[model samples]
Target: MTHIELSVLIPAHNEAGNLPALLDEIALALSGITPVITPVINYEVLVMDDGSSDDTWSLLVQRAQHDKHLRPLRHSHSAGQSTSVWQAAQLARGTWLATLDGDGQNDPADIPALMQAAIDEDAVLVGGHRVVRQDTKLKLLSSRIANNIRRRLLDDDSPDSGCGIKVIRRDAFLSLPYFDHMHRFLPALIHAQGGKCLARPVNHRERGTGQSHYGLGNRLWVGIVDLMGVMWLKRRSRLPALVTGIEDSELLRGESEAVTQAHEESVAAHVVSSRMEALKG
Candidate 1:
């Protein structure tokens, strides 16, 4: 497949009611974008069905037969949002990745601006921050608390990591650890890999159809464990400096040469020993 300029990834679980309209909106918005960098703006819209018992996968298949831009994937079991997105990310042919919620709450129109912001800031990741959420107070409060706790623990410097819409480099997303809820820590993942993330305000809308599939009501402790795991990964990670001295470079080169020379000497000694044994025999 040809490399796409942008891949819009959506992880859906029983979003058949919302997928059609969301796909249409995404198509129109993608069509409207005038590529300033590349002459051609080739993009694909990927929707991964997380083993939805509903007709979500069927709808995606139907859409793909007609819409060339629509790429569909289905999981045999219900993987979490992060895993679904990760699976789609692997299939994404685009150099840049754009992700949004499948529930129709994330505005696809904000994606263009988010891409622009990432370019302007020269950042590896651009995250959407929902300035005005259209959810219930309880949901909003839960998300806020989660975001705050995540920010404090991960120190990702992003105010709204839970926002579903995000634009990031494909390479950066690919480098992230494949774990549940890793999508909620993109900024931190990029930061850990010596890349920066720029946050931009985005429009949030109410879901038009179907209830939310997942919530963190009883999974608070699970989230804490995830947080600790991410923190551990970040702490254990070793990122190379952008520039290093000649001494350091030479040291690495010398070590490599030494190892190669030792291997060669060992091989030669083994050959001589084998030859001597043959002569004695």
Candidate 2:
């Protein structure tokens, strides 16, 4: 019943260690404790427990009881992060949507900054580019390579598509074509809709707990296939801009008549000039 302007979406799978602290940090950030920001951010934290085989669901239910801002949704089976996000988008009631990793590597503090960027730039999608990556060298290398490839191929101009922190206008996000890993291709997808994708450099933290559900192979090969698929979609996609207003139509008609009248007058003047020349001759 508390008015929700922003929906903070976190997709988790066996992320019991991260959620408690992440929720608290989000509360602190939204609590208006930061003197730089006003305490006007109204939001709800919707955690999609993606079929956690652990006590993640139980912990979330317990936490939800005490935290009025928290909302817990569960899937009976383990669905991937992309599915969780797509489903959460359908259920989100906020005017704006913000998504961050459940692993807590993405700072909740950055949410406010991204939200401001979303408003400032009139952004349909605001993606966080991690400035400092606190991960293994392997992860850093893989992510760098992936991002370069994605940017070059898609021409989306996004430096960090894999960064889990992104803010978007909920309606705009829902308008995009959905697929299994559509989360990774949001910038390009939004671009296809003639929507703006704003990028903000944000803080990235090291994972305190929970191993990555993704392996190196999961990060690279599958992404390539998905990237190719999205490229195909971009080639095939076209959106129509339709406006229905009698005033606009009438204005267009009036402009057309004016042009026609001017052309007719020019033709008449040319004929009169020719007749005058003939008479003189």
Candidate 3:
């Protein structure tokens, strides 16, 4: 069995028109990556079709037949983007997960950079900051207001929390508390878990096809309630005390090297064990 290092997850709803090119771009962006940046470059693209009425799921099915890395998941009824991503994360077979917006505004070309940043900075989550946003005046204004309000309240230090491009450790992400709109508060949630998160500048493009799934109502009003919930969660968070004077104490040095090595070895061993179990079956 091949070991996967990264899983690029796309939580899409009615995004058939945008996925073909987006998938190609993800393939191209990931192809150039080598082990120099990470322990392994093997990756998968997991697209979650959240009950789209269009050809999204069919397109993924056809693409996955030809593209070995493409993995498609679906929902019979429309679950929100957060639900799509949460479900996909549980099924991901990679050590790391990179999320991209299905709308194509979040550039696939920036993924490698974000992945690299996550490694370099020792961050569990690396969020993309769209320095120059390409949206209408209304969207820009609404996003700005929302972002500012969230920053003041949550203080997650993310410049663009709405930017749908981020690289996160799969284990770390799974450890976070699940909620309806948890995707919007990733940085804060990571912080609540005593994990580090970094923000890096990334490219953002105008939507070429299909309508955006978000608007002021969903993006702002609903988010306000979610923000309060996250704040409550953060206040209640309590990290485990670090143990010392033992073999695991070695991990306390150098960005938790011992811990990372143990995790990698565990994942590899699990893969081999699964393969052996399959043979037995």
Error of 1 at 267 (Å): 40
lDDT of 3 by residue, 40-90 (tens): 378888898888999999999998899999988877767678867877887
Note the Cα lDDT for every prediction shown.
0.76, 0.78, 0.78
| Candidate scoring better on TM-score of 1 and 2 | 2
Arranged by lDDT with the best first, the candidates are 3, 2, 1
TM-score of each: 0.81, 0.83, 0.83
Candidate 1 — which pairs collide? none
Badly placed stretches (over 4 Å) of model 3 are: 33-40, 239-281
Q: Could you give candidate 1's per-residue lDDT for residues 160-262 as a string of tens digits?
A: 8878999997767776656667787778888877887888899999998988765665334566666777777777657542222243322221112011334
Pairs of residues at least 3 apart in sequence or in different chains that clash in candidate 2:
none
Candidate 2 per-residue lDDT, tens place, 98-126, comes to: 99889999998988888888788777889
lDDT of predicted model 2: 0.78
> What's the residue-level lDDT of 146 in candidate 3?
82
In candidate 3, residue 124 scores what lDDT?
85
